[model samples]
Target chain A: MPLRLACQAMGTRFELVLAGQSEDQLRAVGELALEEIQIAHGRWNAFANDSVLSHLARCAGGPPVTLDPETFDLLQTCVRVAKQSRGFFNPLLGPLLHKLGLRDETKLDPAEDLGTLLDVRGLVLDPKGHSAQLTRPGMQLDLGAIAKGAALDLAARVLVDEGVTCALLHGGTSTALALDPPPGKDAWQVVIGPEKHAPRAHLAHSALSVSAANSRRGSLPRGDHSHILDPHRSRGTRHLQAAAVVAPSAATADAWSTALVAGCLPSDPPQGLGLLTQTTSDSWLLAPGRPSCFHIEPCTTTTPPLTAAPF
Target chain B: MHDNHSSPDRRTVLMAGAGGAATQILPDFLAARPHLGADLRVGLVGVGRQGRAILAELGKFDEVTLVAYCDTDERRLGSAARRAKGAKGYATQDAMLAAHPNLDALLIATPTHLHRAPCEGGLAAAKHIYCESPLAHSIEDCRAITAAAASAGKVFQTGYQGRANPVYKLARSFVRSGAIRDVLSMSAQSNQKNSWRTPASDPVRDKALNWRLDPEVTLGLAGELGAQQFDVLHWFTSKYPVRVEASGGILAWHDGREVADTVQARLTYKDGSQLSWNATLGNTYNGTQEILMGTMGTVRLAWSHGWLFKESDAPTQGWEVYANRQQFHNDEGITLIADATKLASQGKLKKGVGLPHPGLYYGLETFFQSITQEKDVVCSAEEGLRATAIAIKVQTALTTGQAQDISEADLASK
Candidate 1:
């Protein structure tokens, strides 16, 4: 039998043996999900256009974000993650990230050699709706840093509640979320890597992945571009070919691992992540002393670089 | 050695060729597909009557291999021994065992009374078995056979051939799929009025011929025809019959027979599914020619003139019908679903539309296949116990005036 949706208080996407009332309920849930995505997308793009946050010394006017309730909820989550990462994973990077070609507004034209120096403290959030005024314009707010992972964790929770016990949700394949316990099998597993879209890559273990070749890279349908703009170089994150992050969720692993490489953390692995990056010799090297905050482990399995499906 | 990670396989003899003739059915069965992946091979016990016919029938399959053949009658054993190919023939079953040490399955078709011994022998040899039903001489004997199979980890599939009829399979499929909604109850008839056999002259032939009348050996009337009918009914309704009410008496026979000429039974299952059936082998004209009824549909899987009834008006003054054996096979005949479809094709598509043809031989096939795979067969010892328990009660019902309650533990010693 195929996986059936477990309709519960969380949501409704039940797969029935006999097509009964369940068909209509799932369609409604799908609609709600799409609307949520549009709202989140609009909010992120609005932050990119606001000029106040970046020009802190030059201007005093900025735009306020106006999106639906879900988007509002998403921004609130950003405030939470920013607080958790201690501003190190700042969502208020609108000014500095934009200057480095990271904002969704401008068609990014990358300059060579971007590296860390992006200031995290310059960003701020207003507790009220549509009212957080950036000190000046050109301050691009990029929630791209952690919102994708945060949303995945949230959506997985909701989807599981809605009777979707087993699913592979790709919020853009670079970030994937799998929420299934390995019932009648070895263990719950997933695959993460660049070129994950290639037929060759398959999950045999629990995994998560991210790469610099996202859509920001070039003219490919879905290539991982260096979305992480090194504030020092005023350009996209560079060098160290592709990074393969294996954690429980692609959203968190992919986003944070990208942050790690873009910030120019030392060649020796940091304590908080399971980092595997391609070396000049083409072999992948891993980081040391993992962070106790999340579950991540050294992986020996092969994976292709992640690419987007033909939209 | 005690440390374990996998589920324990509690096996029962599923299908072991009793002697050599099982070879007849397999070659034709496996001939079309030379491989069963890794299924068990079958052996036949007796090469007389049913065993002889089965030997030739199995000859049509390539998947069948002759293992060993047994017969108390040395004359028949020698002839069958020559025809059985590489399989060895023994005057007694013990000699055959000394030869095929690796033998995995046995099919017992000697006689209704002789079914238990070979079953016990096969069990001791660690072989899965598919035995002809009634299963044994007494409700007690059948119980003993079932217990031995359970203890030896051998699968036992009682030969209840009519359960293999695709119409019953079709009806079960429909009901399980909930096409008919919660079933209120069900009723079945097996009025197979006499004319089942011919008269015999020789005393020994007469003894075999009048198996129904012989109190000395024959399981009597209920065992002869009632056994097949009850087993099929038990399988069609997943519930073992909780009680049976029956009345039968001997009205006529060619020679003042002790066996009843007419017998009928009414069975009530746990869910209150009522089943009524009659077997009067003396009369042939009254035959409905293979009929089945269900909540969602009704079907006839007879060899000729089959019919399927779906949510509709009552069957006509005469039954709705399809001609030809094509009703049993599909356009390709490669699988069972297509074969059932050819019968069910006329009706609207419903859930569980196709019947489960675990097969008359397919069950036997599964028996041996499980032995080969070292897995247990589908039919459990308890199922054999359940069917036998109902049969004894039905026999008692035919004679005595009350209903009997048989529990799982009651069947254990039985």
Candidate 2:
């Protein structure tokens, strides 16, 4: 049986289940994983004054600020996804989010045009120098959707490096990554959504990320807006109740799920991706090279419970 | 590869000799102290730069009382005493110990040459001792102090603050847990553009303050700066060095100083694990850090931050998805074990500003706790002696231009 350990990190609960390791070894790996998550949280947190993202935001429209290789690569991925999804995965939406009163502090003027500020195209990256600069004055980077995924990826890396072959790592139950399975097991069995309404999927060496409109409670008094803002619409999008994507990486899955939920991409995603989206009419699964399947299920819950099979 | 010849019995005898005086005084000391309460009265020896820093940290603890400040320099003592307010000032360590009979502990931050006297004296007085690193300037003093501390039966902690650092603690845990697999070798470097000289109005006092430049009173870069790094290697490997080969010269700051501003040394353990270290005072290119290599992975650690780099044949670490795509040329490791700047940004500020230098607060806190709770210190006298012996041997190798074998007999001789 796998030993499960849970701890709070990245503003959410993270769980790690490991098999084929002693209790002491499991605890050590768990602690290291949690610490890595915490480190990622500190580095990428947009609201933190001393975070790398905040520093980049502050240095916008100025000289390029040097970043560590890990952060530089993460930003490079963000830029790639933003271009691929036609500005849907824009990290430079901090001003728009702040203007909508979603973020803690408003560093931008409400009267200012957010279209110019949300332009991810203006962000310049020096690959050789390992530095980045935002060409626009009001542009700010927010890695909210991707940082947790990156942190999950880091946790998985730490576990695997520690000689753990079979492990299930998750960030706030929304993004889950499965390492290699146990000695005799084919894959880690994972159930998506609620018990009666969810579909069971076997995962191995892959990650799954879920983004739902109701995942974050609306902070507005009228309950009209969500935490996930649409960069193109310059507002919150709730057209889809939920969207889930399975990819080789949690970071990729996380960004794609957010893009799908924002209605920026079609229901049919790119190749090598398994997608599931829930709408008012019906729930659909869009697997690569497979026909879309429809089902009737209630998807009103903010957070769908996830279940992992025994190791 | 060096052979393992050191026996446990020799170590026991060395420890026994070190603790002899303290054990004899323990009963009377316990009898004399009727009530051991929350408060711990501590005397400060060598209230200079590092001493004052420790004093400020000690002031933060409510359970600590800075009862006395001792320094050969009256001016520094007076300045430290002013900050301490109610604490008494003494011109000499002997006077301070003589006056402060009720002091529960002595914090020795004296010069390298001066550590042995105060440390030995404090143990003789039945007071728990916390001495700054390197143990002493010379091997003889290191042996004498180690034996005295072992004999004392009181808590005797060496000032290797990395022992109390959280990052070091996590890294050590990772190594001890066998996560890094079989150890191969280690490399460490410390680069700085520092003269290591303090200004003084009096010529004699200038020489005294600038003890680091004088070979007679200094351990050079290997002992003075490399002691903590060497101690960390030993801590992670749980083994002492069997041989040390060193070479150095006064490559910079040629102001009549006899000590080398640049030095390099290689230490070999009985287990065949080797550690290579180098430090240069002329350049600040890659400011101080250590890297431990293992069969499975590599751990790169500085004072405030650390990262884990897995080997190519090791199991796939998932972070590589993010790390491998980065634009930078350097390797992006999997786990960021400790990053003080990031932690502080997240509002986890309990550990103080995580600079490259080892924070004195945690070490001092551990010292106070050991005193009141009767617990063992994180860095014990024996551990300090081991590191010191290796450091001294490195210096000897540099002087003789040959590799020196460090045997258990060397430790047990004194």
Candidate 3:
């Protein structure tokens, strides 16, 4: 069991573990976790300003924020994964994620206009110097929410590479990834379902991720309200209990699961699957019925105030 | 690599755990395990005719200690566990591993395709992984296993013990010592009606009863017999097979097996040395021979039998065939023409002949020795991966009517 910041290796989340030679191994792994997180999360560190990617990314177009490799790699992954997933997932929602109390509490105050101009296409991918060229001037990419997943994948990879074969990476139960199946267990036993008074352990093979109204709220979605905004409505969907997604890779699972929770998607999931999803009314969908390894628990936490994620 | 190698730790686990993880790993895998000996501690996975016979042979080991027994068959697990020294039996891999944490090493007799997990899991626990043959379901699985072994720095050698035998070792030493001059093309083949079968009979029905015949299990007979044959090639040449082309069909068992009852393959190396072989489970000669053709002479070795032929310059050589493989002399009785092995320190050999021998069992001993010395096992992790790659290449060719080119890149990717 290892824990480290999964700084966008797969998606957004700091991977934390219970097993390693020490907490230092986990920390050391997190320091070098994701290629993107190195810049994206680096902003929260002592070398924040010196790292051109995150610092310049925050204030692009106004001034020619020089291109750095970190931001370059991040934008590249977003475009590639977005293309592969057919637009169901887009990192352009960073501002929207921030508004939902995800990235930073202070920046939750958008600059006058937010979603209307939010376009991932507006972010130009540059090659030579290797960095993003924000065509829309004010446009910024906030991969905080989803980057944790990419981070989980990276951290999981580190544990595997380091020699701790049986382990799980958990980011306070919100974002997580696993490396190799548990020693003798079929998969990491987890709970990703509706709340039963007490939490019970359930075993699963696929990477499991859960996002729900229990996290936070942005604006008010038509009638629903939660931290996750309806980008179009700039609000949350108080209509869902929790949306869970599983994928062979953590990034896909994290990204898709959030999309589903945000009510931005229908049931068209990915290949190699098993879905047991429930909406606000409690009516649910168990795609192809229950998976071989499935577990659910009622984990409803008051949304954490949005802040720069401590990667 | 032999499934029934003796180990004290292997025996004690049987007292508490019957058949542990092996049963649960693959519920339908089957192989006939022969009666090893007596009071044997034999926990096995894959209950095919070969696997079952292995269990019986495992019974031959002292104490009949079968710590854990796993099979795709739930019925087999229960009965085998109850029958074998009250061993703990499990139907799932987790239960088995959990039940017997001290499992010395596993006797992985699963079919050619389903051999990955047990071998990997066994090695993870630092156990003496005594797998049967062809230690992976696919090249990908084998590579993953090899990587895992390297990461863990564990002792690993597959169940290809033919070249490990003493007779083949001597043959290798002699041929390499220049007794067999500049080795050219070598042709080793098994020809019989059953060796090269007719065609498939009933594909659908066999799938339900037996999976060994299943393309998934046999991995094609090429993986089974051809796998061992390819290992012999590696032993003599110290080079990965440059390419292999194979084709076959089931003649008799076509009605019941997914895999071809008969199989044939040609392994071509960069140096122009080629080896071809055929095997069918019927009256297919049941005879095995390895011919080392060199510029100086030709050495033909039959199973347990040996012989040599020489060119004009080789007057010291006698042309005679040996009746028994063990005797010091042949029918012509001229010392069976011993080669000048005493002249050099190994690594100078050009050609060598090896067949499936108990001597291959020595590779297992070497594994334990390496473990004790904290050095690498004789058949290194990379060696196991290479052997498995060649095995997969042959299987791929048999599956697709065309030869699948396996580049080092492809092997590394797997």
Stretches > 4 Å off in candidate 3: A1-311, B1-43, B56-66, B78-83, B190-209, B250-258, B315-376, B411-414
- Cα lDDT tens digits for candidate 1, B163-226: 4444444344534544344444544444543333323434786476445557676655567656
Per-residue CA lDDT of candidate 3, range B105-219, in tens?
5667765566677777777767666666676767777877777666765556666665544455445555666666767656555433322221122444234334455554556
TM-score of chain B of each: 0.72, 0.82, 0.69
lDDT of 3 by residue, A93-211 (tens): 65665555555433533454774446666666766434356555445565534655655555465455445555566544665565554445555555443343222223232465666
Tens digits of per-residue lDDT, candidate 2, B1-414, equal 112223212122123322223332221111111233488899999987678667645533556778988888876876675556578999887888788898999999988888998998999999999899978887788888988987988988898877877667656666665657888999999997556765454579867887887767777888888988888887877777899999988887666677888899988889887899999988877688889889998887877666667767876533243221112166656433333223323333222223222256667766776888765688887778778877888888987899999998665526
Q: After best superposition, candidate 1 residue A259: deviation in angstroms?
A: 93
Give the interface-residue alpha carbon RMSD of model 3.
Answer: 33.1
Question: Candidate 2's error at A40, in angstroms?
Answer: 28
Worst 10 residues of 2 chain A by lDDT: A287-296
- Scored by Cα lDDT, where does model 1 land? 0.48
**Ranked candidates (TM-score, high to low):** 2, 1, 3
Tell me the lDDT of candidate 3.
0.51
Model 1: per-residue Cα lDDT over A111-196, one tens digit each: 51112223433334444432233333333355663455544554554444345444444454455444453345433233333332
